[model samples]
Target: MSEIVFRSRFDNGRRKAFERSPKVSLTSPDFYFSHCFGVCRKKTSMGPPGIIWVASRVTQPDKLSEERFCEWYEGQHIDEVTALSGVPAAARYEAVPMSELAGPPTAETIKAAEQRPDYLMGGKWLTIYEMKDVDFRHTAEFKSLDGQSKPKGNLLDEIFTKAHFETRFGALLSNDDKGIKKGPGKLIISATMTPGSRASAEDIEQFYEREHVAEIAKCPGYVRTRRFRWVDTTVLKEFERLPADPIEPGNSVVALHEFEGPYFPMEGLLKADETPWTARVLESLKKNGIEAGFYRLKRVYGEWLPGSSKL
Candidate 1:
């Protein structure tokens, strides 16, 4: 199993509330959550929250009106898609006011329809987030795809979706964006490579050097990437009672890269039809013989509001 921490880079007030009093019951209304990692039986540190909820009206790029897009999105119920993908934690959806949304949202201009009383009352942008958990990475499942079950989607598709997710609410974290906590916009992207052929310690070291990992700093949004030697135990028990059910302990090297600044700016480029640049970066890694799947993460938090139930 793998675990990660997720957080938002916007709203210092909310982030403070989450950290100061973090923990929410699964039954809470304002705190809807979900996780790709597995079941979250208990809570952990409530670090802080971020604006990560994202939905795109232009999946195919027909350029529909904001009203038409909203209607279409509601009809599709993409939330159900998120839930069905084996969410390990509970998550909720929030509609942020246009003023609160990170980026400039076109949705704000649409007036509420005559019958939609509830629609006009809230903000134009929406936010969805998962509940807090300490051991999120440990619950995620990473399976090998056989030649038969290879992924059907192209790399551009995957990166675009993620970029959109990270960037949609990223505007709030911008240097000029107000109410951002000092450390609000920090983020990490982790990559776990399942070697096509088992690699030795020397091989790993050589790969990193050969792949020019030292040059990651050259990238525009590049922060820092660290390589882990793969700790076999998920938890340490008194240095005597070893953890019983740890995830795969062999043949994997974990690389963690930290990104500071905005949520994910890569999506903006992708959305604007800049696949070549994105592809070039990805291809560069492949050229260096480095193959790994990248997963981005943030920290979610729960601020125990007065009258909020605890589990």
Candidate 2:
């Protein structure tokens, strides 16, 4: 049997809610077989088939106030995008600051906080648009929103000049729907990564389906976890050209975990990952690295209905 330690950046400041205790090893072959077999029961398809995830940081706040920026985003931009055929829903989120937490800071937490960008630490805002399929990008309605087609002096143009954006398109891989709560949780953990050369996509998928998601589910307030594989965005870039320089490409995979929260359940989450399987998976992906952030839901836009402008 292999001994693999569980370590997380959230483990530093010990809060009663975030503490972990050791558990009996389940690394034996029999346990692995039975656990994997039982947990891998058949299910419906993953999550939404296609999604557009955009994270933004306001670089020139003097030129555009956050209030005005959000007003245009929620009031106008979301309406424009969701009105297109095959696009049904969207939501917005804001990054949560570490200083707002009640506990003392841990070294790891401090380091993580320090690494965040000064503009907003993690991204200041995130918007997610759900599509019926990845092919929605090729539709004429979508193409009409291209840079060449936008009015010269639109609010969107001003937004582009004042904000930096990172966008990703994801195709669903798997979803643990059994644990999902009634509505979107107040907090979301967005984790992006690429599997290292040592691991295959199947390895990552199986690990989440069999162990990782279930473990996280054990934590208090855990809502659901959805995983996605990155879709190439070369074409999207050609369509929606903005004022800012192009952003670097995103990671190959993303996992979104929703949690009901007053604050992040760091202790429960750290303890949840205390398994040999988690250690093994993390080690495999270590070479590629993981980027994760905490964001709180600011607002949610339900499915777009025909002939309705309501967001």
Which candidate ranks first by TM-score, i.e. highest?
A: 2
Worst 10 residues of 2 by lDDT: 1-10
Candidate 2 yields a Cα-based lDDT of 0.58
Please give, for residues 1-311, the per-residue lDDT of candidate 2 as tens digits.
00000101121233232334333233343332222111122334433476777776666778878887788777867777777766678778888776543245777677676665422324678777777775455444554552313333553446655665556667777666555465567788888756664354457778788888888887778877777766633212112323211211333677888888677788877887788877776676645356677788988786732111111
lDDT of 2 at 238: 17
Q: Deviation in angstroms for 23 in model 1? A: 35
Q: Please give the CA lDDT of all the candidate structures.
A: 0.30, 0.58
How accurate locally is residue 249 in candidate 2, as Cα lDDT from 0 to 100?
32
The window of 10 residues in a row where model 1 has the poorest summed lDDT is 166-175
How many residue pairs of model 2 clash at the backbone? Answer: 2
